[model samples]
Structure formats: C-alpha cells, structure tokens
Target: MKGWRAFLLRRLAGTAAVVLLLSIGVFGLLYLAPGSVQQTLLGIRPATAETIAAVQARYHLNDPVAVQYLRWLGGVLRGDLGTSIRTGVPVADMLGLRLPLTLALTGYGTLLAALAGVPLGVLGALRRGRAADRLVVTAGVVGLSAPPFAVGLLLLVVFALGLGWFPVYGAGEGLADQAWHLTLPAAALAVGAVGMLVRFSRAALVRELEQDYVVFARARGLAGPVVLGYALRNSLVPILTAAGLIVTGMLAGTVLVEVTFALPGLGSLLVESVTFKDVPVVQALALLLTLLIAAVNLLVDVGYSLVDPRVRLGGGPS
Candidate 1:
C-alpha cells in the first residue's frame, strides 16, 4: 500500500512539473514571435499608433506579458482554454471535438502495427536463417526507410485511385465512415511502427531463447511451443516499454499523416492554428499533447508491474 501511494505521489509530481514547463513554453512562444500581438491581430503592413492602441485595448494586449500569461494560465486551470483568434470559438471545444479523431487514428494504427509486427517477429526469430526471416527483415527495413506521407500517397493511389477500394481523402461522415477513410493513413503510420516492433521483438526473443532458463525449460520436457511461449512472454517487458514510447511518438507523427489524409483531427487543427497564429489554440494543443505523452509513460511504468511479478514484489522503483 505504501509503495503504491509513493508511486502515485511521484507520478503526480512529475505531471505537475510537466504542466508548469508546458505553460512556460507556451507563454514564451507567444511573446517571442516576430511581431507584437497588436501587429499580428491587425494583419496590416504598417501599424499606426492609434491602431496599435485600439488593438491592444481590444485584446488586453497592453498588459505585461507575465500578467497575460497568468490570466491565460488561470483560465486554463479553470477548464477554459480561451477563444481562438481565427474562428472566435472556444479552444477547449475545438479540441474536444478533434481530439477523438486523432485518438482513433492513433489507436487503430498502433493496434494494426502490434498485430502484424509481433507475429512476424516471433516467426522470424523461430525461423532464424529461413527465407521468411529474410523477407521480414527486408520488409522492416523498407518500412523504416519510407516516409509516412509518401507511403500514404502511394496507398491512396493504389487502393483509392487504381483499385477504387477506398476513398482518396477526407474522414467521411460518421465514426464508421471515418474509420474507412482512415485505413490508408493508419496503415501508412503503422508501417514504421511495425518495423521497429518487429526488429525489437525478434532480437529480444532471440536473446531470451538463448537464456539458461529457456534451455532448462526445454530440458524439462517442455515442447517447442511451450518453451517458446515461456521465453517470449518473459521477453515482452522491454517490447511493451518500446511500444509505449512509440505510441507517444505516433501522437506527434500523426500530424503529417492526418494532413495527408485530410482528416479533421487535432493534428489538422494544430497546423491551422499555427498558420493563423491562434495563440490560445496552439498553446492548448501543445499542453494537451505533452500531457498525453506523460500519461502514456506513466501507464507503461504501471504495466511493468503487471507484466512481471518481480516488479510488483517491490523489486525497485521504475
């Protein structure tokens, strides 16, 4: 009980620190932009003093940058992310609608990668020098080397244009429709993820297969499948850790993939916000992304205990 309490407290502290850093970064980015807030708001080549004062008054831009930052931070803490400069809509609401699409795309892509990668990895490890192993290695290399947008375009050309099996762009009308449109993009994102997972899993399994415990299991009359399963299960801890990190990376990487596919997701919103200099929207999105990454790391740490009994037995702090 004490250990669990300590773990929770540590995670809370880390989260708080991350949130503080993110807030500071957001504030600094807004303040350090090339032009003043008034200049940015007016969209004019030359800023008259009268116009500048009027604009500053309109948006409370005349306040000290620190004061403005605190006001925004306070609003965020109160669950209000402020209004977008471009659309004049609440940033929180915009994110609320778009966040689900991004999550869905990432979740499906990760699932596909894991499903395809793990089995291929196990097969490659078990086959060692066979043709199948060579093919897996080559495929993994290609997946890793290819750019995601290029892969997405190629898939669109083949599946949507040439074969007419799927839509070329847009996330379609509903959730199910969106998923259908997401197929190509998700596969594109999954390519690199699967490649990395395959290589990691295969190497880990190979190392585990050579361990003394694996040999002992084999000597104890365990069949090939049983011994392999035991070894693979033990080796999965590191793979899970790697997968967690990969998921976090995918959260960021999905921006390009989403854009390529024209999906109405957080990534697309972020791009639009940056282009328009929608300060509140951009800050909220960045802070949310950081929180997501931190949350995933915490989940993976907890998963370590679930995967290995030694971890739950107070082996050491993760």
Candidate 2:
C-alpha cells in the first residue's frame, strides 16, 4: 500500500511539473505570434500612435512579457482565469459552457473508434494472410494517409450533401438531434483512430498468439476461442496505450472537425480566440486541453494495471 501510494504521488508530481512546462510554452508562443491583441482588434488598418498607446494601457499590453505571464499565472492559480477581451466574458465562464461540449464530441468519437477498431483488429489477426486481413490492413493504411479535415470534407459532401443522411453542421438543439448532427464529424475523427487501432491491435495479438504460452494452451486442448480470448487479454496493455494516444490526438485534431461541423466547442473557440488574439481565452484553453491529455495518460496507466495484474503503477515491474 505504501509503495503504491508513493508511486501515485510521484506520478502526480511528474504530471504537475509537465503541466507547468506546457502552460509556460503555450503562453510563450502566444506572445511570440505575430500581431498584438490591439492589432487584431483594430483590423487591417494601422492604428494611430495615441490609439495604440491607449490600447496597450487599457490591456497592460506594454508590460514585460514575463511580468504579464506571471500576472496571468497568478490569476490562474487563484481560480481567476481573467476575462475574454473579445467577448467581455470571464474566460472560465466561457470554458465552463464550452468544454463539456468539446469533451462530449471527442469522447463519443473515441468510443466509436474503439468499438470499430478493436473487433476488426481481432478478426484480422485471427484471419491473417486472408482477404479479411488484407482488407482491414488496406483500410487502416488509407485512414492513416488521409488528414481528418479532408475526411470531414469528403464525408460532408457524400453523407451530408450527397446521401442527405446526416446534417452538414451545427451542434443541434437537443440531445438526440445533437447526436444525429455529430455523426459525420464523429465518423471523421474516428476514421484515423480506428485505422490505427486496428493495425496496432492486430500486430499485438498476432505477436501474443505466437508466444510459447499460446502454443502450450493450444497443445493442452484449449478451445480456439478460449485461447484467442487469453491472447487478447495479454495484448490489451499496448492496445490501451494506442487508444489513449488516439484520444489525445483527437483533442488537438478537433479544431478542424469542430470548424467543419460548426460545433460550439472549445476547439472552435480556441481557433477564434487565436484569430482575434484573445490571450486569456487562448491561454486558458491550452492549459485545459493539456490537463485533459495528462489526465487521459494517467487513466491509461491505471488501465494498464487493471488489464494486467503483473503490471503495477507503483514503480513495480510489468
């Protein structure tokens, strides 16, 4: 128990350190980006000297970048994310309303990816060198090759415009309606993830099936299905890792998907915030997304222990 407790504490400390660095990097990039907030607010035309000076004074734009970063960091530490210059709303409030929407979109898409990927992977692994295996492999390769936006655009054209099946855009008015609207965007996000998962899962399982234990099980007259199940259980750690990575990637990739679908999610907000140079909004969103990715990694690590008892998160051997 003490070892596990120590292990968790160490893991948490590492996560906190990484998050701090991530926030610093993200904040640093914002300052380095072209155009000041005032410039974005002012549009294409250049502002007069006096107007620029006034704008800087109003928003503390003239403060040293390090000082500004410290001030913002201090506010964040105090649960005050500062107000959005663009919308005149508290950044935290804006995120509160939008974060859940983004999470739902990403989560649902990941669910679809896993459901589609895992079984197909298992099937291909079991039927290696056959037509089914070739087809699955081909699909995965195509998915990996295509960008998510292209997939989103193509799906929009075919399923939304051509087939007239799912809606082209928007988050929709109600739960059922939103689910319907999310279908294509979710599918687009899931495509690459599903493909990668299938390929990884197939390879992991095939590797496991070739192990002496698997052969011994077969020699001992174990049913094929039972042996397959055993191989699957053993293969899960790597598969889980792959799924976690896909989920993390989905968070970053959501911007294009959300833009394509017109969902009022954080990805869209981040894009808009960047475009308008909404420093508070952009900073807060980056920190939040980084935290989410960290959380996912932690969860996957815990999942590893659950899927395989020989592995322990408390600095023990696999």
Candidate 3:
C-alpha cells in the first residue's frame, strides 16, 4: 500500500510538472506568433496610444508575459478558462458543448477497433501459415499504410456517391442521427487503430504462448481455446497500455475527421480558434487536452495493477 501510494504521488507530481511546462510553452508560442491580437481583431493598426492601451487592457495583454501566464494558470486552476476573443463566449461553455461529440466519436471508434482487431489478431496467430492469416496480414498492412483522410475520401466515394448508403457530410438530425452519420468517419479513424492493435496483440500473444507457464498449461490438458485465452489475458497489460496511448492519437485524429465531416466537435472548434487567433480559446483547449491525456494515462497505469496480480506484486515499471 505504501509503495503504491508513493508511486501514485510521484506520478501525480510528474503530471503536474508536465502540465505546467506545456502551458508555459503554449502560452509562449501564442505570445510569439506573428501579428498582434489587436491587429488581427481590428483589421487596422491602433495608431493612438490610448487605443493601444485600451486594447491591451481589454485583453489583459498589458501585463508582463510572466504575469499574464500566471493569471491564465491561476484561472485554469479555478476552472475559469476565460472568454473567446472571436465569439465573446466562455471557453468552458464552448468546450462543455463540443467535448461530448468528440468523446462519442472516439468511444465508438475505439469499440469498433477493438471488436475488429482482437478477433482478427487471435485468428491470424492461431492460423499462422494459412491463407486466412495472409489475408489478415495484408489487410493490416494496407490499413497501416493508408492515411486517414484518404480512407475517409474512399469511404465517402463508395458509401455516399457510389452506393448512397451513408451521408457525404454533416452530422444527422439528432444525436442518434449523428451516430448514423458517424459510421464511415469512425470506421475510417478505426482502420489504423485496428491494424496497430492487431499487430501488437498478435505479437504479444505469440510471445506469451511460448513462456513456460503456457507450456505447463498445455501439458495440463488445456484445450486450444483455453490456452489462447490464458495467453491473451496475460498479454492484455501491454494492449491496455497501447489503447491508452491511442486515445491521445484519436483526439488529434478527430481534427481531420471532424473537418472532413463537418462535425461540431472540439477539433473543429480548435481549428476555428487557430484561424481566428483566439488565444484564450486555444490555450484553454490545449490545457484541457493535456489534462485529459494525463488523467487517462494515470488511469491506465492504475488499471495495469488491477488487471495483473504480478504487476501489483512486482511493483516494477508500469
């Protein structure tokens, strides 16, 4: 218990430090970006000193860079992420509305990836030398090599234009309708994920099956399915770790997919903010994403111990 607590404390401290560093770097880039906020907003440069002062005061840009950073950091700590310069809406409110859509897409896509990848991996490993294995390998290679936007375009061409099976763009009439619209985009995002998962799971399972315990299980009259299950389950720790890492990638991937499909998710909002140079919105979204990724990774680390007794007992690197 003491060791676990210490490990968790260390992890939390590390995460906090990383978050601070990331915020600083993001803020610095925002400050150093070409053109001033007033110039971006007003179209014409502010010639009068009073006008420049007013602009700086309005945006809190008058403060020293370090002071501005401190204030922004403090606001974040207090859950007050400031307002968007372009829209005059609170960043938190905008994020609250958009985050769910992104989460929904990511959740469904992850499920699809797991459902398609795990069985394919297991079957391919079990039928190592067969035609089916070769087919699965070929599919995985294609998936890994193809870019996501290309996949999205191909799916749109086939399903929307060629077959009229799905909509070409825009979310549906309602949430359920939106899900229906999401099928192709989610599948496109899942393609690479499924390929990676299959490759990792197959390799891990193969390696685990060669261990002494697996040999003992085989000697103990365990059937093929039983042996496979044992091996796969034992290999799940690394798979879970990979899944956590994929969540971060999925968040970034949603940017392109959302833009392609015109989904009102955080990614689309982020792109708009960037184009408009909405610093507060950009900063808030970046910090929120960082915190979310950190939290997910922490949960995955904890889950590793829960899933494997050896992990808990060994107390080695997770």
Better of 1 and 2 by TM-score: 2
- Candidate 1 shows a clash count of 0
Model 2 steric clash pairs: none
User: Would you list the rank order by lDDT, best first?
Assistant: 2, 1, 3
**Where does model 1 exceed 4 Å of error?**
35-40, 43-51, 313-318
Error of 2 at 227 (Å): 1.5
lDDT of 1 at 215: 89
Worst 10 residues of 1 by lDDT: 309-318
Q: Give TM per candidate.
A: 0.92, 0.95, 0.91
Off by over 4 Å in 3: 43-53, 173-175
| Per-model CA lDDT versus the true structure | 0.86, 0.90, 0.84
TM-score, predicted candidate 1 vs. hidden true structure: 0.92
Q: For candidate 3, give the lDDT.
A: 0.84
- Could you tell me which residue pairs clash in candidate 1? none
Residue by residue across 1-318, what tens digits does model 3's lDDT show?
788788778877998898888878888988887878776666666557787778778988878999988988888889799988888899999999999888888888888899998888877877787998888888888888877778888999999889999998877778789889999989988999888878877777878988999999999998988888889888899888768877777888888888888889998998998877788888888887887888888888778888887676236854
**TM-score: which is higher, 1 or 3?**
1
Model with the higher lDDT, candidate 2 or 3: 2
lDDT of 2 by residue, 128-243 (tens): 99999999999988888888899999999999999999988888878899889888888899999999999889999999999999999999999999999999999999999999
